[model samples]
Target chain A: MTIRLFLILGLAAGMLVADPQPQPKLLRNGLGQPPHPQAMVIEKLRRMNPEERERVLRDMPAGRRQMFERRLEQWNRLDSGQKKKLEGSLESFRTLTPEQQQTVRGLFRKFSETMPEEKRGDGRRMLARLRNMEPDERKALLSSPRAKARFSDSERDLLAEMAEKLPD
Target chain B: MSPNTMSCPLQSGNADVLLSYCAHMLDEERTELIEQHVAMCAECFALAEEQKTVWAALDGWESEPISAGFDNALFARIAAAERSSAWEQWTAPVRQWLAGDIGWKPALSVGVACLTLVVGIYLQNPARPVAATPTVEIAAQELEQAERALEDMEMLRQLEPTADEEKRL
Candidate 1:
């Protein structure tokens, strides 16, 4: 029975790894939203002449250039509120140690890839709630039965790590 | 019969001279020098004796004479193999598998059984929702956007020193 259970778990994990899902973004304004723009970089880049902008992008690999261009386009699309929310998140993100930043990135990727779509709203909401709570409150909410019913142990851990490192 | 003052050949990493001495291939002066060193060094003495024994055994061994038809027989066998049908070549592995010469069948059975079990469990659990590819693709794009945003912010932060200096002026 133990061996069979291990086999099942191993197979499940293998399937998740093998799935060709895209990783989640490290920083976004919210679900169904575009990435937040940094005012300084966007303004500086925007102020550059076309030739200067072209020169800056000329040396980048094609995919990197495209990604940068896509981001600039997203920046162009965002209104003030979305940009402000993202700026706040980005400020919090910048305060983390490099290792912590990497951990948050990994957790976000895991959440996006593994969590069910229906539960993702709950996951995001829980993350937002945890972000505002005191450490003890966060701990209480995470260990509560509501948290248990809604998320797996790993998902809860993902939320906790994100909250600790990227708290508002 | 003074103790040899030269470095031990093995210690000096120059065992070629010792090997040459064992094979009796060295000139008289070099052989004498090595012999003196070997006599004073037990490790070199053992190695030289082992090499000499190997040379003696190899020199005493004889090779069997080949039949004159050996080359022709080998060429004929090669031609016969080359002339065999492509179908037979392709089907050889399948034939081997059917004949139980391969070990993949059992492993494959176990893998299939495991996959079936996982799929059954997954389907039985209605709570586990599968994410569609389009959603994942969108998520990936969003991630790229986020990374780019961070990079843009970092670029601006690096330029902040210059911006701050301007503000001071």
Candidate 2:
């Protein structure tokens, strides 16, 4: 009886300790890759012994390692939905017409650099909100005077088109 | 078999130690130490194996699902019980008064009514008459101001990051 009681308490205490742990939010844009995959791989490497870690390091050339590290940082900066969508649509993205690709690239550059630092959070939140809206509602918003005030007529129309392309 | 062993010490404090060691929840050295102890102590070996088996069995256990109404029924029961408990506590003084035969209910009701009447009369006192709608034009002007403010609030709700929009993200 005492053993059973102890076991129950032990399990309860163990569960309490674990229940609040933060789980990595999974990306769900149709890709099967885990959230923060690059970080997870790096964490696993940190857990390895010096010899095994060195062996893994030796397996990759310095140039490859540097490129991988840079790519890892870039991947880390992408939000989960973006990461998932990019992973799933890499081939399709590459196959896009040059003009389409250039437009997408220009939009990304504007988001990364042209957007003011203070409004970055608002920009991201607005993008996420716009993505979450229904296609019909987004179309209405695109035509609304509010959007026209903020974006040029051409820019507003382009954004309305991009709404269908981007994932929430 | 020994009830306790130095190797797999079944002390109250070390209750989690064996379980942690078996589950690989401990670091390498601690796990190795416990592993050696289990190998040396037959009691601990059996306990560890038993725990592993129990865990495996639990993993295989499929729970019987309840009906959709189960949660709603449970919540209703909880709400009813809470309401009854609060009611009982609130009326405890009355119950005590009844037990003592002091006629508390009538006295309490009369006191509450008197208090309500005083407050109501105080609020409706005509002495400092609430500026009864003055000349028709000023009343209309106030109504217009109110309408303008309402329109401004609606525009603000659309222009700014309102609560619902922020929460949607």
Candidate 3:
């Protein structure tokens, strides 16, 4: 009779623990993250012996080596115009190293959680402007107090004028 | 039959004439040739059979009949719609004519009349010069005064140098 009571109690306790609330799982590398193998490899490869690292790289599958070679070839084939566009994109990536990328990602995640849908368009336009601007110009615009003061005035005037002219 | 039995019809009937006969879309000669080929060739006979099957299937498909009430319903709807639309159509032009803001003609006439009056007045009044022209002696005296003032200013400047020069000294 005592064993049956213990078993019942144990079962009740298990059921209580197993209620529908979602539990957090162990975080794994490469899960829910961008595939930036080059950065990862560089970090780890430094710890490995130079000869071992060289051997590992040399012994990489022919297909993967060919893929990397093809990527380089494709990069080389891009015209100056294409290169300039790609450089504009890469400039953003270069601004954030992996650690900064994580910080930015966390900030955006929080912002997405809190931000209203109406302000999304403003954010997109801001990002587009940042992406389009030259590096020095973007830096100056962000850093300059005068630029910040003028930005709102000019933007407001432009928006007001556009609103007046736009069709219903 | 031997391979040579497969005779080249061109050598027998002139290739161009035979080709032209074949090219004739509805000619009896082309029909006869096709019939003969179907009778003799297994491949053409099979193709004809396949085509006939397709045509037979197409011919077999019958369109579903429309409902018995369809014509009556359609006619009733069309008549009612026509009656309502007739009223709308009849009123539309009247409404437009009455409601239209046709201000341009009167506005334009007034604008033109005002413009004409202004032009006429300007044309009638030939502009005249003033009677009291400058006296030569008074003008010479004013010029002399202006020269004296300039000299005085120059003397003041010579006496007191600018702040920058004073600071340097």
Best by TM-score: 1
Show where candidate 1 strays beyond 4 Å. Answer: A1-38, A47-52, B1-148, B151-169
lDDT of 2 by residue, A56-127 (tens): 555457775555445444555656664444444443444566677566655655554555565444544555
Per-residue alpha-carbon lDDT of model 2 for B52-147, expressed as tens digits? 998889889999999989999999988876778777878766555545555545755755665555555545542432332211212333333333
Candidate 1 on B67-138: residue-level lDDT in tens?
999999999988987998999888676556555576665646866886776676655553544554322222
- Once model 1 is optimally superposed onto the true structure by TM-score, how far is the C-alpha of residue B148 displaced, in angstroms? 5.1
List model 1 lDDT by residue over A26-139, tens digit each: 344445455444444454454556666676566668897787776676666767665665576566666777777676666666776887877766666677678789989999
Return the top candidate by lDDT: 1
The residue ranges of model 3 lying beyond 4 angstroms of the native Cα positions read A1-168, B1-32, B86-169
Q: Point out the higher-scoring one by lDDT: 1 or 3.
A: 1
TM-score attained by model 1: 0.37
| True lDDT of residue B4, candidate 1 | 59
Task: Write one digit per residue (lDDT tens) for candidate 3, span A1-168.
Answer: 344345445545544433332312322233355423332232233334545444544644777545543443454465555444443333344455566545444444443454355543453344344444665655655456854553454443332332222112
Best by DockQ: 1
In candidate 2, which residue pairs get closer than 3 Å at backbone N, Cα or C atoms, i.e. clash?
Answer: none
lDDT of each: 0.66, 0.54, 0.44
DockQ of 2: 0.02
